[model samples]
Target: MTNIYNEINALEGAFRKTAEFETLKEAVEVVKADEEALNVFKNFRKIQIELQKKQLAGEDLLEDELVYAQKAAQLAQQNEKISAMLEAEMKVSKVIEEVNRILLKPIQTLYEDIQ
Candidate 1:
């Protein structure tokens, strides 16, 4: 209930950070794909499957609880993606720093030659 909602909110908040969001998103996707096999989603799947059938028949889910869970999924996905992006960014930054260090050695050599 409240705990679920809080996790949803935190995921949403971290959504914009691409690396984190990607990481979170992958986790969320995995959780969703296995929800049918997972205990927590087992009970809900019955209703969810029915809801999907109804939706296909032109009826839609109108309950706030269902919507909240869906939102939680999206939020979690976004957070995962953001986390991933951050990690990638860190790696790229490190690579750039290393490159700069290597390039400076050549510049130093050239300066020494000029002198």
Candidate 2:
């Protein structure tokens, strides 16, 4: 039988070498080089994480928090380096989503067969 862990590790290595991953790495480095951009990105990420946590905990999002998040997002978009990094991140996310779908095919097929 094939070792699933080994296969997963191999997949991870291959994923790291993909163009999307490389672009994201470069974009991150560019953001890191720009202090202002990095600060904006970090602030946005912090707000995002806080909002996500609140959502996961079943707590309501306050108006101020939503407004802050919106403003942070707008600020992040205004920073060229941060914007590039976000775009690169989206590309990497798409690749990961496709990989996840591919990996779930066996389970999906099994469920369909049961139905």
Best by lDDT: 2
Per-residue lDDT of candidate 2, residues 1-115 (tens digit): 9999999999999999999999999999999998999899999999999999999999999999999999999999999899999999999999999999999999898899674
Q: How many backbone clashes does candidate 1 have?
A: 29
Error of 1 at 13 (Å): 36
TM-scores for every candidate against the unseen true structure: 0.28, 0.95
The C-alpha RMSD in Å for every predicted model, in order, reads: 19.4, 1.0
What is the Cα root-mean-square deviation between model 1 and the actual structure?
19.4
Q: Give the per-residue lDDT of model 1 (tens digit) for 2-112.
A: 786887577556544556445545544555565443434444455567667878999767788577657644443355443343455466566557657875897788789
Backbone clashes (count) for model 2 = 0
TM-score of 2: 0.95
Q: Which stretches of candidate 2 lie over 4 Å from their true place?
A: none
